[model samples]
Target: MLKFPNNFLWGAAASAPQTEGHSLLNGKSATIWDKWFEMNPEKFNNNQGPSDTSNTYEMYHEDVLDMKKIGMNSYRTSISWARLLPDGKTLNSEAIKFYRSYFQDMLDNDIKPIINLFHFDMPWWLMEKGGWENRESVDDFAFYAKTAFEQFGDLVHDWTTFNEPMVHVECGYLYGFHYPAIVDMKKAVQVGYHTLMAHVMATKAFRDSKVKGKIGIILNVLPAYSRSESSEDLKAKAASDLLNTRSFLDPAVLGKIPEELVDLLSENELLPEVEPSDQQNIKENTVDFIGINYYQPRRVQAPTNPKVPAKMPEDLYEPYDWPDKKINPYRGWEIYPKALYDISIMMRDDYKNIPWYVSENGMGVADEERFMNDDGMINDQYRIDFIKEHLEQLHKGIEAGSNCFGYHMWTFNDCWSWLNGYRNRYGFYRVDLNNHFKRTVKKSGLWFRELVENNGF
Candidate 1:
């Protein structure tokens, strides 16, 4: 049987926006998701949106109890910005009370709380003020982070400034995957730079307050692989990695921008306006650790038309599909567990051997009910196998000198996703939308409990 390091944590991650229902209740202001759904109801699948979550707002106590019962040693969940500071400055009393109680429940259950301050849930008021594009939002976010630290720092120790800040730039600004969807490259750069600035500012707040726990950021770190050994393919892979991974990684860990990334942006005339002192701010406020949310590896080749002006990062590198690659059909993502090993190596060699953890990784399936057995429990053996395979790679990484201390699956309960809605389920507990959002432990969950109890399998 494979084993994990001593005192290693095993749990799941969720977010306030994805798991918390009562999106509009208790003085909670509207986030981009809420406003977007209000305007474009048809954009979401199954006509479901943020309010369709698993009711974690009301059910957080029970969820924490359930997590403890399942032998989860820790949990990662974001505190909704809109809910905490609805107007962006004032702390809503009721929202603060609910979050404090929710976090305390985890502590009482002997579960460590890894609190993330933001997770793609932009407050509507801030979005109206140009969101991250406006530098003022940087100050606004710093204030919000400081407030969170002041409020809950004693009860929670592990804090992350943001969850996948790059998605805010790519999906919302450069691509059309999310709300405020626009395809503007220049604005994407601006948004991205400002996001890094906000992160630094938040990190500064965490340090200035001398909070007791580590501060980090969750990045979707998909290692980019070349399709061929050709120079063009190699260059494509480099560009993809720089834009997608290092853009956030280098600054957060090394406290410096990758100079090559700067050159690429400059050559493409896609550079965002940078303040003269911004680098110093970033360089000084690097994170104590990193959170890797790896779902797949990226394979890229030379773009067919590089001569054309680069409007998007995708315009610079073409995606390549490897022959007979394992794929999660429901998510259409390449399933390459070996990438976890490579990523750990990358961290050890390239990023000062910075401490980190597997913050989010899971497979989502459709119609999970079809896997249910007669005992009313879902026999999700596929998910169990998925976790086993990924953990094997993670174990190899740890053995090979990666400073990975823990592993958190994508979520605890099946959450209400952004656009895909409730169609895809990724959770230890199967959430039956058809049955009053009933929660049942799948076979994977039972296996997970044993894994945690043994510290491995």
Candidate 2:
């Protein structure tokens, strides 16, 4: 039977904009989400914007009680930059007070606070000022990082700089899923470079502040697999790897960009506008750790539409419809439990066993409440099985000497997912969207409680 280490942390994660209610509380201005919801409410499902979510900002004390009940030792959350700095220049005292209380409450409950700096919720003021497209925003983010370290560094130990940098690039750049959406590869490359630069700068800030905790960047790691043993499929898989994984992994961990990316960017003339100082900063200030979020794997073949004109390799596989590939029916992600083990081994071998953690990993389902049967709880046995299977593979990776330290699910409570909204539930505890955000323990939640209590399943 596979087992976990005694010190292995078991808990859940949440972001501010997704969980915290967007209210004009005590002179707090609206963020990008609040502005976006106001402009087009219909864009969200059930016309539900960020207004009516979990309200975690206000209910954090009660939420910690729930965490204690569930046997969580570490609770991961992000401090919203918009909430912290509404004007992008000054620190909001009211926001700082709330966060202070929030951190104190977590520690009071014996829950280690794993705080993240930014979780895709940029301030509306910054968005208006050209967002990450402008180099000034990067400097602004670095300042915000320093401010956070100064304020909460003592309480919060594990500091994650950015949540899923690849997702940020995909949503904010190539795809128009996120704010200030620009569909240009050149702009995406610039955003990617600047984001890495921001991470490096933030790490420097945390170190210079003499913070007693670890600083890392969260990356969504999906091990790319070839569709078949064919050479074209293998080549396509390698290219897809560069596009998705290596693009961020190389810069963050190795303090260098992959040669393939450099060649591709040069060929397409989409290389980032890197200043002399930018290169020096990136090389000097690499992260101390990496937080890997694994869900599934990517299988690819050669590009059928070579004329599509996007140098990024994900575009290359847009044309071919590969058969005999497995996928998750409940959610669109492909299920490859083996990919979890492969990803862990890859991180250990490729990155020289850098200290890493499974920051976010879970299955999402539509209408999870239906899984409830004669009992008054959402039975979610499948959710339990999903996690158990992943953990078994993770244990195998650990046996192979991977430097994984902890495992935190995608969320703590049911919060609003970007684009998908609340339709997909990934939380251990089910949150009723209708019942004033009432939290109920699912079967999986109970199972996790015991898992955490015993230190393993």
Candidate 3:
């Protein structure tokens, strides 16, 4: 049996780009995803792009009601920067009207709306101006943040500056999985550095503007593990953690970058240019809390042959494939519940016990329709089991005194994913693509209701 503390926030998460469709309609400018899908439909699976994801823009009243019916007290979602401001300078009135009604629906349903500012959907106008790589984009994001705070800060009290900024750095720049795919380590470094700078700048604006909510960043923290206890392997782990986890974690939480990481980048001559006041600003303004989105762990060993340039991740470490690892068969992700406990323990011990929550955690299954019951509900027992196992670990972490306040699944509706499109479903309610995008709650959703009502199971 497992149980959570009193007043736990039990809910789910979805992003605007992944949920709100009508890409070019209603004065919404194209995002990187919209443009990239337009240019390279072949890149997406089955040519299914995010033309009309869950139709939340039109269906949000019904969707938020569904959330309340499922017993959710909180729902985390992002505001589309491009949708809110077509040019990133002037605000869109229709967009503001839509968001006010949408957020008011959440409040009317007695649900706390946890709003996230960015979720990798960069505006095309901003991208053309060098996106996060250019220093000017930092101020642009801050302005967006200030505007968001001014408008919706009264209605929403929980705000995150960015969700998974590292994904933007690595996917868009290093791995080229995203739009404007540039595969340069120097560009990657610059983008990553500027992203944190933007985060800090936005955080400063939030405090200075006297927003209603406690502002924070949502990081997909990958707790790194060494392949072996060898010195080289541990060194590789340090490097990997420094690059991904600590880069944002330390700055957002501790108000500083890891000195070791700075030294490494400096020695490699890959350090991004910084202003004299950046460090002091970071030092003064740290997050009130953070959202941790943990899906997997990073296992690494020293690269067999480090590149002479040694700029990319592979140049420093080799990602290790654990032999005895359990994996999710549907999505091929490693299933490691213990890592949840490990992360919480590390947060308790290493990070001064900062307040945090499990921001995004769920299982993605392909061909979920096969599990549909005759009653039209998805028989997603596998998803239930997945969430239960993770919650068990979370319970242990909380019992051990980690200041985790909530548990939010990856999504509520089967929304559109960027790279894979909707190939795999990770939602409590199945959104039918063939049936006018009908929304139906799954078996896991019922379980979620009971779990939340009971404070656990």
- The alpha-carbon RMSD values of the candidates against the true structure, listed in the order shown, are 0.9, 1.8, 0.9
Cα error of candidate 1 at position 4, Å: 0.9
Provide the global lDDT of candidate 1 against the true structure. 0.91
Candidate 3 backbone overlaps, count: 0
Question: In candidate 2, which residue ranges exceed 4 Å CA deviation?
Answer: 308-315, 319-326
lDDT of 2 by residue, 247-315 (tens): 888878888888987886676677788777766776777777888888877777777656445655465
Tell me how candidate 2 scores on lDDT: 0.81
Superpose all Cα atoms of candidate 3 onto the true structure and report the RMSD in Å to 1 decimal.
0.9
Tens digit per residue, CA lDDT, model 3, 1-457: 5889888999999899999998899999999988998999999888888778889888899999999988999999999999888999899999999999999999999999999999999999999988988899999999999999988888989999999999988998888888888898988999999999999999999999976679889999968989999999998899899998999999999999999999878777788989999999999989999899988778899899897667788888899999999898867889998889988888888888999999999889899989988998999999899898899898899899899999999889998998788888999899998898899999999999999889989
Instruction: lDDT winner between 1 and 2, please give it.
Output: 1
Where model 3 places Cα greater than 4 Å from the true spot, the runs are: none
What is each predicted model's overall lDDT from 0 to 1?
Answer: 0.91, 0.81, 0.91
TM-score of each model, in listed order? 0.99, 0.95, 0.99
